[model samples]
Target chain A: MFLAFDVDSLKYDAAGLIPAVVQDVRTNAVVMVAYMNKEAVKRTLESGETWFWSRSRQQFWHKGETSGNVQKIKEIFYDCDRDTLLVRVEQKGAACHEGYFSCFHYRILPDGGVQVVGERKFDPAKVYGKNGI
Target chain B: MFLAFDVDSLKYDAAGLIPAVVQDVRTNAVVMVAYMNKEAVKRTLESGETWFWSRSRQQFWHKGETSGNVQKIKEIFYDCDRDTLLVRVEQKGAACHEGYFSCFHYRILPDGGVQVVGERKFDPAKVYGKNGI
Candidate 1:
């Protein structure tokens, strides 16, 4: 039975941040993880898109605001403790500026050398805005 | 001013997790995010590899562990807060199972329709462990 998933059940880390795992809704691949403060969480919920605070930039950033690449939230699920988030988004174009659908588009050889198994699809310096990645 | 950077100074997210931003390092693209508990951090630290906790899998998983692609950490830096991480890696293949170098490799069209600007480089169902993403 599908019951109401209680928000109280969600757990946040000591800094009021939660671990959010972004998966390729189509491919089911684990994207990256970022800490979302309560406001980031609220922004994500309110905008129906992914939003997080850039620890470095120290500001709120929408996933696609700078770049045309946007993650439209199709579904949002919380882990048992609510400390983690599983975001299902419909991505358009290359989700990465490295010219790949995912930034993970690489592999390590048995000898520890990096090998290229995919092709880059975009130029970050152009798409990521003047601010850059 | 050229001294070795201290790993101890690196800040990690709560849950003993660090906010790692996997960039193309080559293209300078931002990939997805995932929390790395202490062990995961250590694994990443000692190996010069990116290791993180799969909250869903509840275990340790290296980037491109199952996929032929892998991220060989070339450089890892910490944010001022000591809570975030900047991971520079040489991606060898598709960083995402969706067939992109990065998961954020998508951009929403002006009309709100998802568009495909990149090409798929691999078949994840075949690469990722039979367990899948």
Candidate 2:
């Protein structure tokens, strides 16, 4: 049961943004979650790459445009509600800005303890600079 | 590499909502993505169950409350950005209201086609009635 990508069918928030969850295609590991606006969606569709609307930067950014950890889009799906997106991609390098393979690096224990699960792939400071990229 | 769950360090959206991506603890399959307000987070933590703030209803809902498809939370982690949450849960039944094991049932192809990858677990109409639960 599959459907075509119909932008009109999606339900964007009042801010005209929708959530996009990225996953590693090979491992099926969820890498990161980000927001996408109309422009970002259009660009992602056109470029076959991940484009995100940064809430903090208040702008559209191409994934790996700075870090070279580009996410080549393999497939994309919207949930039944159409407010959320699941994007399968071929991830290059690490997904986390903190130099991890995925943004979900920490694990919460049953007793309220924390543990690091994912391995560090690179040094963010080296790639993004000391102030951060 | 891991950090503790500090609610104070999180940066909630302007609407006081944070996105939470739920995954199956046993399978590592992403089940659903929902939003959570401060109250939802508190209740989920206290109850050991998944609680979400439905955007359409504009209210908090305890997962599996009416449908009995409860999600027992196993772990919860916030992304480095502090804007997203990763919740691992032990799902009892179908996670999607549509009776699918996951809300992400449809898959998009590279050539703009769609495919249904997951199997239906139950009949939503039978469970929720004609108009749906």
Task: Tell me the deviation in Å of residue B36 in model 1.
Answer: 5.5
What's the residue-level lDDT of B123 in candidate 2? 90
TM-score of each: 0.51, 0.90
Interface RMSD of each: 12.9, 5.2
Worst 10 residues of 2 chain A by lDDT: A1-10
User: What is the TM-score of candidate 2?
Assistant: 0.90
Best-performing candidate as measured by TM-score: 2
Local lDDT at A33 for model 1: 53
The digit string of per-residue lDDT tens for model 1 on A69-127 reads 77887756553233556666787666655556665444433343344545666777778
lDDT of each prediction vs. the true structure? 0.62, 0.84
